[model samples]
Target: MMWGSSEEYKAMFVEETNFYNRIILGWFLPPMMWENLPHFFQTWLRNYIGGVFLYLVSGFLWCFVIYYWKRNLYIPKDCIPTRKAMLMQICVAMKAMPWYTLLPTFSEYVIESGGTRCFPRINDIGVPAYVGYLLIYLLIVEFGIYWAHRELHDIKPLYKYLHSIHHIYNKQNTLSPFAGLAFHPLDGILQAIPHFFALFVVPIHFTTHIALIFLEALWTANIHDCIHGKIWPIMGAGYHTIHHTTYRHNYGHYTLLMDWMFGTLRDPTVDNDEPKKVC
Candidate 1:
């Protein structure tokens, strides 16, 4: 068989990639919960389980910080999402999560076979080139995501069939940290397509790529909270909240660079006129 075409290599990759998942699963699942499973199922299982872990942890952590530890800090008492709304968000996110993990699993398959322009070690390209490649990779993802998001709103059919599920939480009363991943499964995957696509266009570090993809779960949670982080250039929650309301602005992820370039950027100050208590 060709390289990475054997069951052994696939098993190896799944176990290696599940480093974090295995740690958590060790406590909950039986000693050999993963042993009898096929490699394909193991990969999907670890991904889905890891995603659920991240979702609950990040979503609740943000809720605690904003609504409990520091009540009325970023949003008013009346502005917080109701329990039912948050529950709907959680339900939608969990439903979409299984499908959302598929892309990363496919990405693992590609990386396992050396199918993309990925380098496992910084020594492969030196520190300077590694940093440069990282920047380039980010740019590709940013630009791709900007358009992918904008097109989702601009294209009537796409918005109606795929993206409107996310827009359901447009108002502050409905939006929350949990609403970040509260998307149609296809919608979430479509938006994340850029992160994977960048691997083909740039020499991305394999570990860095995987980390960024997972970090997105937390980042999205942060941006849906309606808190203006004031991290200029970065698209903070204030910007994203307005995007939800306006439906025609702030169509970039991670940064405002693309939104500014496309003239779709709107200042978050209008809605964030309240006290600026950012963390």
Candidate 2:
């Protein structure tokens, strides 16, 4: 909470010292304030401002490389995506900004506390802390994201209005990551729980938390976007592309373990049963 119209956010981000982390918890601050605002305000402001921030920073960098460096920007021809369309996706995601920010914070905290030290949040959590706090935090974040994502699908009315826009991308690309944020306002709130709950539930360090957030965003954005064929010869982005090809298959967000355990994984080698056009 850093910029709510209420006294709450202002005090934390602007009024308080070390406003970013101490008050709002670093990366977690912007989304929280965006979420807490009145729904109407959140919709317009969050999409326009937040979306532009994300798109411009990323787009400008990519455009720079493409234009100046003369490197081929790998966009799938079939994807038929445009800069404008991708930017619009940012507005689509604005609805889910709050939860997107908040829940991941909790997940990061738990992971940094040594939950899933196996994955390791770089060196920030430290080897010792990771070993001590790995399992519980990892399980909590995994289950939280899995079910939250699943619920978004199973709940029909909710999915039709909120989650459907994400599925609209027939072919995934840099724009693919923006797909998930098009949730209903209510769906956005639901997604925020994992982080808020983790705040009180888990004991975590700040650096570990920041590392976790970066990892989450990186993994997610990479899987959904940059990985076109496969990072590795045998296995890589193809695994996630299969999930996009058949939305029902890949529900787990972080690790591939959950989908394996639940038997929900769709093998990249297998032909899709009935591939639907991107809605």
Candidate 3:
């Protein structure tokens, strides 16, 4: 009968779906390599390999803009922290490497769980699934990081040891962007822990993960250089500069939601006139 034949086809489709899920984790790595490798040869090749490559390319652009053009690239060397703060920033960035290493494994987990939907083949899942996955993943990740950043300041010893290096450059610049990565190893883990939840609970796309890392790094630089101790236009460096000026306010790391919701938003112009301090 026609009805009997249709039922058999449905059963076969379900079997194929389950079988494919088992191999989903394998797809994340190859794509990650393609997106992450080029920068290795530039800034990080000498020491950190990939990292040096990225930094060199980015730093070159940064230096040229500030040095030759005099365009007021947010970070002026004079604003960077001195002695101890600079040392702290360097050490902290080194410590954070272990967590950064875990990203690929986490990405695999997200895909398997249907926590993300930004993969190339995801279009096969239809537009509804793709859009839903993207929205949820972005919200969860942003919220998690915002809270984690806020907590870093609440704890005293940890703030001094791990997070302070970022503040060392009260005036943003190229060097200041990398300062946070030099946090203590523990700080690195703590900072990255939020991603674990997203990896485990969401179905994220491979491209989204790469995009997040790239955006995060670029954001760190932007907030330091572009905002340069001022607040403005919502998403730019101006907003982050307020955080540097008054550590207690502006707790949101990459978004305005947390600061607004948690009552930590600051108006930099109010009390931003003080002489800059070394982190």
Best by TM-score: 1
For model 2, what is the alpha-carbon lDDT of residue 141?
A: 68
TM-score-wise, the better of 2 and 3 is: 3
- Would you list the C-alpha lDDT of every candidate in the order shown? 0.83, 0.50, 0.52
The candidates, ranked best first by lDDT, are 1, 3, 2
lDDT of 2 by residue, 143-242 (tens): 6877777778788976797666666664643345554344455665565455445544454443444445435433554555534453332224456666
What clash pairs does model 2 have?
103-195, 114-133, 114-134, 115-133, 115-134, 116-134
Tell me how candidate 2 scores on lDDT: 0.50
* Tens-digit lDDT string for candidate 1 (145-164): 89999999899999999999
Model 3 bad stretches (over 4 Å): 1-49, 73-99, 105-120, 171-175, 226-233, 269-279
Q: List model 3 lDDT by residue over 121-147, tens digit each.
A: 455456787678767776786678777
TM-score of each prediction: 0.89, 0.60, 0.64
> Of models 2 and 3, which has the larger lDDT?
3
lDDT minimum window of 10 residues, candidate 2: 9-18
Give the candidate number with the greatest lDDT.
1
TM-score of 3: 0.64
Which ten-residue region of model 3 has the weakest summed lDDT? 39-48
Q: Kindly report which residue stretches of model 1 are placed more than 4 angstroms away from their true locations once superposed.
A: 1-15, 18-24, 270-279
